[model samples]
Target: MWWKTARTRLDLGQRGMIMGILNTTPDSFSDGGSHAGVEAAVAHARQMIADGAAIIDIGGESTRPGAGEVAVAEEIARTAPVIAALRAEWAGAISIDTMKASVAAAALEAGADIVNDVSGLTADPDMERVCVESGCGVAVMHMQGDPRTMQVAPDYEDVVAEVRRFFEERLLSLVAAGIDAEAICFDPGIGFGKTVEHNLALLRALANLNVGGRPLLLGVSRKSFIGRVLGSTDLADRSWPTVAITAWAREAGAMIHRVHEVRPNTQALRMTEAILQGGNSAFSG
Candidate 1:
């Protein structure tokens, strides 16, 4: 399968892609405020590209549980410069991770190639138009509710089936609104509003969420669910589980893995792909 972005086409059938996370906000759950300035953000993006990241996902607002909304202007001020610089510096795909159309528009003008909306294009009515107008790639995620209230009493009778149905409905809506089906991707929105059990169920059944034959993007790197499951709050302790899931999800046919630590996860994904591709007897254990 191929995902067509504004600037590049990703052939997902070949191998899994790593999307390095660049949180421009000061409050993202992990690695926030580390690349607050444009120079620092661009430098980090360069390094991630060298580290084998296929895409750079830049977000200016913190969507962590209980995080408040950022003003549109503030969000634009934070992300646009970084995206602009990276667009000029790097040739890989650059995605603007925002829920607001205004911010998305600014980023696109400044040189972003895709829109990764956490709201699934439902938060701002204008976001869809921005994407359609620019002909950029989109990742519509399944979030139970807004960041402030998503984790509060989150419930799902059948989480996997429910998310699959959501993807089906959104695909139709987006296509009808002029977005190409091939330009769209699906994300299960892990930890967005899920309990640990819900997240685990979705992870285990991730292959079932591949609706309309579009590619699936999994973003479980260092998420709170990993912490809760491992009984640890330190973010550093979750990398092993994160890499393990990266391999498992890739084996399950996920096309993209959004991660904070790019190098190790990239190496792990390469190894997993090699194993799944079947090896010579000499390389077998």
Candidate 2:
């Protein structure tokens, strides 16, 4: 399978790809204000690239539960410069993670190749048109509600079926709106509005959510759900659980893993892929 973006096409069937997260905000649940400026963000991107990130996902607005909205101009300012600098230094894949069309437009103009909208192009009126026109890869995620109130009282009769239906509906609409089917992928929106049970159910049903034969993008990187499952709030404790899930998701045929910590997840992905490929007698143990 191949994923076609504006600037590049990824061979998803070859191996699982890691999308490094670069949150350029002060309020993101994890790593907010950690890489806020272009210099720091670029430095982190370089590290992630060296550590095996196939794509660098830059986000300005914090989508954490109850996160307040940032202005479009503010979002652009936080993301565009880092995207431009990364485009200048390296030609690898870069994604702008935003819900607003205007911020996505600025990021695309600044050299982003994909729009990783957590809203799945529903938050903004013009998101679909902008994506269709730009030819950038689209990641349509399933969130029960907007970030500010998503987790307030999230509910679903059947989480897996609802998400599956959401993906099916999105696939048809996105293709009808002129996006190439191959240019689109589906994300189950792990913790956006989900409880621990909901998140686990989605992970267990990862392979079943790939509607329209499109790839699935998994982003369980140190999310609160992980910490909750492990009975720990410390980010450090969530690291290995994150890696384990990365391996699990890959074995389940997930094409991409969006993660905050790149190196360990990259290692987990490579090891899982190698093991699944078979015929490697190099390890006798």
lDDT of 2 by residue, 1-285 (tens): 999999889999868888999999998887888998999999999999998899999999999998899999999999999999999989999999999999999999999999999999998989999999999999999999899999998899999999999999999999999999999999999998899999999999998887888999999988888888888979889888999999999999898999988888888887887788873412111
Would you give me the overall lDDT of model 1?
0.91
Instruction: List model 1 lDDT by residue over 190-243, tens digit each.
Output: 999899999999989988999999999999989988988889999888998999
Q: What TM-score does candidate 2 reach?
A: 0.97
Candidate 2 accuracy as lDDT:
0.91
lDDT of each: 0.91, 0.91
- Report how far residue 179 has shifted in candidate 1, in Å: 0.3
RMSD of each: 2.6, 2.3
Model 2 worst lDDT run, 10 consecutive residues? 276-285
